[model samples]
Target: MNKIFSLLTLLFMLIYLPSQANDFKAVYELAGRHFPWLKGKVDINPLENKKQGDAFTIEVVQNRLKIEATSTSAASRALDWYVKHYAHQSISHMGNQIKNVSKLPLTNGKISQSSFVPYRYALNYCTINYSFSFYTWEDWEKELDWMALNGVNIMLAPVGTEMVWYNTLIKLGYSDQEAKAFIPGPAYTAWWLMGNLEGWGGPISNEMMQQQVTLQKKILARMDELGIEPILQGFYGMVPHDLKKKIADADVIDQGNWVFTEFKRPGIIVPTNKQFENVADVYYDELKKLYGSDIKYFGGEPFHEGGKTAGVDVPKVAQAVQTSMQKHFPNSTWVLQGWQNNPSDKILAGLKKENTLIIELFGENTNNWERRKGYNQTSFIWSNVSNFGEKNGLYGRLQRFIDEVYRAKNSEFGSSLKGVGIIPEGINNNPLAYDLMLDLAWHAEKPNLDKWIEDYTVYRYGKRNPKVVAAWKEFIHTVYNSPVDENGKVLYQEGPSESVFCARPSLKVNPVSSWGTRKRFYDIERFKKAVAVFISASKDFKGSETFETDKVDFLRQVMSDKADLAYSNMVKAIEGKDQETIKSSSSRFIQMLKDQDELLQSNSYFTLNRWLNQATQFGKGLPDAKLAMYNAKAQITFWGPDNNPKTTLRDYAHKEWGGLLSSLYLDRWNLFVERALAGQTVPPAEFYQMEVEWSKKADLYKPAKSNKKNLARIQQDILK
Candidate 1:
């Protein structure tokens, strides 16, 4: 009997213990589907070692590159490894332009490398809303491919979660109308998930909601095949504010409003309540039915971003939530965003350290992981969120990222520091920042920045121009390498110091966003010199799209930075009642706007129409298309209902994109200049009114294309 039982156990192990598919079929299929350009050039095959973490071997034999890995994502990353190191290429979160070299670099033998991190991750809650709320399957395919290439094996994939919530709510004894009322629209779902506000940007069409579920199915399948782990939204006791009305016996807390506003937040279902288990069962049952049973990571923040925790035992409630998750998906990791005062100590005590992953969200501005002791010994990822709301700006503390990630890896809490991640609110700017952060996953120690950048410039523009290299070095010292004082206070403004041109007309121009400062942290003349150097190489690199794009961007900043000096003169003229001088200063400021618009139009990455068109196109053929356009415009602009001028959230997601600078910002400045000249009161009412009208329009604007010569001419004109 014992011999028979041993034989049966061995058979069971063979059937079940191999958790991973351990094949390149799925990966090869993904490559053929998404990046068909790489079909004949690259080939993937499985490595024999199944127990090892995602590792790969790359070799170029007879011009056919064979990549062997433990998994498909590993294989994909191996391809990226070759592209980045051998071919002198870069694929970043900001832009996707991999140079196709006709001649391949010769690889000696099989070159092997393994991931230092168990998990490489991406995205922020704001990222979903700011950048990807309008993503189609094609958009998602490209993004997932980029993620895999960047070695992002675990990502927050919460697309169509609103629909899941809607479906689950209906199953749990709620009417369809109640369910629809509970769900926020596409643009505002991120905050809704965070328990910030509920039902704000809604009246979501059924068509749109259904479309999301279908889209999510594809996203999940692709992610699974690519070896990228999809972190789904877990049940964390957030229910519709009207949950009590729908489920009479539901023990829910009425979290009043978010950020001292009249905006109602979703109700928190008390976790200790026996009803919590029942609701969770229903929720997870639906989750598994919709997505699948293979999910290994779950993300949900209880009492996120200042959500109320009154009348409950914090630790016990946390325990209950985790218990529910573990009960449904045994041994699954619970992911938490390490934002301000989040995943409180009391809550952390309740969680099992091994199963919890904390994302240190604001690594650019604050070192929460280091301060919080790695969330009291729970596993954490050091993340860099250099951009917010996909706001257009060229800024990042690159050296700080390298220093901190190295420190964390070598610190006393190094064992608990699991990985590095890029959690940008928007992932479209500062390509160098993302590449450097992700590169941390490969190196055990700090990479020589000077040497790394030399290679980066080569990959960025195909060949190294001495002037271009000097410019980048200057950028690294001035913008990317910000100085910090004692107590970790950076001697720099937060979130891309607002350009004076983008600010509301005032004698004293403060930052556009509340937490931001108008202080110019770096030397303006030094930054200008860097831009001049880059433009000088435009003749040599005129054919390179990457070079031209970056050149135009540099010129745009040069024009924007000069606006402060012009604004200062304008203020002096206004104070002296000198109409002629005021007109002259105002004319210069207006000219700067025109130049910026033209420069930005030269690249799709910098164009305002890219964002607006994507948002509007999402609501195409729907009755509420106009409403969708309004939501998109409002998110990037006023960011609140017109009733609240004093709302702090307004302008938090502001962008200085091309069309916006040309239209909305220009109109505001034009009105301000006229009022100042006429000695009329310049209240914000007219500008606000104009903004509302602008948001209502759905007209498309084509981005004007300009060549490198044109860009260089413009740069010279601006600088001169």
Candidate 2:
């Protein structure tokens, strides 16, 4: 009887194991249908090891993969866990753990390459710059795929709020024209949604508004499939500025100034208004119809981004907004951005602590987090808003800031620091900074960055050597750790005010540009030696299209860096009055710019057109009050000297050159033209002649009135 029982048990074990393996295959096939890019590549083999126990491991040979338990039951629980949480089209886990790692090397490309480990439950805050309507299903799918593969499970998706607002406005008897005017253009949605400015570049078409609502539905659906939580924009008493036109008794306050534009700041509607209750009800009802009433959190603010409130009871307004939310959802939480001097004490004073959560956005610099620290009340996430509005630059929370945060989290304040989050305005700029930040979230203790970088390099590049590994380590230590120079004061490049310039010329004065400095600081000679070996090994595999593209990208980075370094040397030589050196350097710099332009133009994968456009706009004509419109245009593409360390002569020109020249030389030029044409027929050629002569005089330096104190004050204002 014992022998028979043992034979029966063996047969049952064989049948059960095979069925379990087949279950993973089924899940993979289902996931592949949606994420077609993962077909045939993702390994779904169950990891059978003494340590793994009953857990099935799925791996991707090319990218990171995440896994988790699907259910509580012991039998088939692990499989359920893997299917529910880990089985996704974009990211998979199987085979050797190392094989499923990222294979893209670090490069100074237009977009940064990043990956998160254990890849299952990470949240990615990729601030989409273009109009949300511009992104089609494919674009959103690809974005979610990238996020999923990199382990991003949380995202800020506020697309359909327009529908909610539209419905509310319609129910309030406002005409479509008035409502459409309140919504902004696609590019300016983030600011509008944040309640900073409204009706600026607006008058959106009904089609466009509907398109965003439809897109949000798709976005939310896909995010749900991949386990990414979407933070919808909540109503926080943000009403149309023109509300007074409809309601004679409406009370509102004007929000100060609109950043980067001359548009009138929008007014905030009083939440206490009887109309407010109706608007909230209609808005959330529409939201529920579209997205289902399963939301746990709503992200919105009163007097947000920069709106204002006059004759408003702060505590009452806060209570009303919270009360309205609960009336609809019962237990919804409000997620607020802990920006500079925002969510003032008065506003947060009367709110229930448990129903609110704050994201300590600038935690890298101001301890508004530690100071308020949940206002001695609620939970918060330690988040860093690294890039401002997807600006192209390298910056992050300082090492000391991270150290302090880590230490604080493990201390008495740990309860308040819920989890670390990446609240970047842009996600595609700095890969290393993000990877490092995310890594800290999972580990119990801090990692030895040097060793971790080595592993990261190997995983990113498929194969890594001693030289390449060494280069990455050097990059992390030198360029990444370089300090920013603020008006001749040296400050680490990891805080809110830190300059965007990645490296300094000699630590004496900050360099004018971030790009060239980083290139110069990197040991190019050593990098080339290692790259040569990589090129040789990759040469034969160049026939493969993907590999070929990767090779081109890698080589382009090398050439671009070399060009930047050459340009820096040229600039230095020019400053030193070394004519021969200047001539050689300028020639090289121009050639490199030309080559880079050509490379970008030729390669369909990436383009530097945006940067080039910015460079051109900055160098265009003189500054005039009329040119304020043009300056604003340039500001859209190029960051000003305010927070950017890389403020250049070009930037200064956009800000002051035109105005300064106009003030000093405009009178003389006009006089010359008027005199030259006095009493006789004036030809356009004569005006041009006068202008040429005036240009020479205008270019000369002149000592202006002593206004140092005023200028310093103006500079401070500019920074704000």
Each prediction's TM-score against the native?
0.93, 0.64
Predictions in order: lDDT: 0.79, 0.50
**Poorly placed runs, candidate 1 (over 4 Å):** 1-22, 29-38, 48-52, 93-102, 486-489, 704-713
RMSD of 1: 4.7
Clash pairs for candidate 1:
none
In model 2, the worst 10-residue window by lDDT is 88-97
Q: Stretches of candidate 2 above 4 Å error?
A: 1-126, 130-133, 309-311, 374-377, 394-405, 482-589, 602-605, 608-720
Error of 1 at 510 (Å): 1.2
Q: Could you give candidate 1's per-residue lDDT for residues 404-493 as a string of tens digits? A: 888888888888888889998888777888888887787766888888888888877777789989999999987676677778676644
Model 1, clash count? Answer: 0
> For each predicted model, how many residue pairs clash, with residues at least 3 apart or on different chains?
0, 14
